[model samples]
Target: MTPIVRDFRPDDAEAVAAVRRAALPFMVTTPEGIAFEVDQASPAARYRLLVAEEDGEVTGTARVGLAHQSPTPGQAFVNAYVHPGHRGRGAGSLIVTTAEAYLAGEGAAQVYSWVLDEPHFRTFAERRGYRPSRPAHFLRLDLSNGELPPLEEPPAGYELRAAADFADDPRPLFEAEAECTADEPSDIAAELDDYEDWLADTWSHPDLDRDLTMVAVADGKVVAFSAARTDGHTRYASGMTGTLRTHRGRGLARLVKNHSLHRARAAGCTEAFTGNDADNGPMLAVNKWFGYDICATEVRHVRELG
Candidate 1:
């Protein structure tokens, strides 16, 4: 078994997506999305998707890059995944080593990754000098058969609309996203205040389903939104769901999310996934009301740089 790591090619999309699905079923990945990332990765991220080939067969992958989107300099992330059947071999460790070298070359001082809660996975990271930090949970909802809260009309003067309605101008959506993200509970806070950068990264992302993303508007002002990302097949994921600080207790987040999930179900998505920090009590409560169950837990681990 000769396993070698190499940079990803356009043809590796399907195989890459397959490996990700088997290793982490919680996140939805598509061939197009994989390709798009490789083509559009920011220069600062130094993003490279590496595949581990065992005797000409792609078995594992590593998404290695700087957290360029993050305001913190020298912060990098390496998410490595090896297929179940391919585990126990050196594929996973090799990918990690390869990614770390690349990030180090790219000027990443401190590396971070989300190690699965499983004993072996956690042990692997700890042995590599990475200490655990914040923890996040991955949740799933069976939209096909599970019960979902019925969608309701927003209060008078407040209405629900699809994100596509703002096709002509999405600056308002960016404004809302920036505000909500700044308020999120996270170990590494994100500041996404630039619209052009947001356009290049978020709104124009391959998986963003504008028609399915629900937004709550009050008096023509975009106040709350639930962005939906889908695989165009059977899986749906809530990319982000948030409400502006001005309208927190108005049930707007619930309203937009419920509508987005319903639309996803109608569009043939059977499984839905969302994640949250353990400290985000408000979001955990919201997800529970929507009938989502905890599927997997990932404890965020961080390591200091020399």
Candidate 2:
């Protein structure tokens, strides 16, 4: 059956999530999360969720959008995934072609995609005119059976709190996140200056597990955090974990992430996942200390539009 590409509909949320789970099990994806992304996307993002249907079944999906918050312009991204069972069909190709055309029409000058480091996936991206850029690793932790580092009490003048603790006023958390994000290593730099957008896109996200998202406070201000996202079932993922520059080397990152993992396990989560840039030795070492094993690697690929 020939594959056909089309815009995502509300009812396609479940199928899209299913495809994502099948293609990348390390990441948490849910129907509610999918719906939230489509419904809450800012107009500046020019976001489009494309689905490739074959014989009336969603075989592949692509998330196409501009890097609206990036300091640079004309930057866009397309993450296309096909169910393992559906590979070699035209689904992936159709989805990528459609995504590129849409991004081009939206005035994108360059497009980026993350291709799994496996041979076939790399070949697919190269054939589509993408060149290798940065690499990252996906790590997995066995929350149910693996022994998590014992939780430790915060040092004097510092306290640990759940993200929910900031429900009334999350600006403190946002400030910390923006500071940490600015220091993160990325090919496309993003500046989180819009507090309202952060509230809508991050604080109110459906998958954000506030109870499991741990925050570290010093002098009554947020200094570090481990943002968590859960599937509302057995899967949990670290959306972002970082510490303010001045607070680094104080073990805050480990403190917050370990605390979150322990709480997530107690809350019945069986699996935990996170991604780290290949060159980020500190974070990679941190995850290693938490007994996370590298499960998969992805290489960022970029193509410049003429």
lDDT of 1 by residue, 282-302 (tens): 999999999899999999888
Best-fitting candidate, scored by TM-score: 2
> Residue 91, candidate 2: how far off, in angstroms?
1.1
Score candidate 1 by TM-score against the native: 0.97
Clashing pairs counted in every model: 0, 0
lDDT of 2 by residue, 267-298 (tens): 99999999999988999999999999999999
- Identify the candidate with maximal lDDT: 2
Q: Which lDDT values do the candidates have, in the order given?
A: 0.90, 0.95
The 10-residue segment of model 1 with minimum total lDDT is 186-195
- What TM-score number comes out for model 2? 0.99
lDDT score, candidate 1: 0.90
Residue pairs in collision within model 2: none
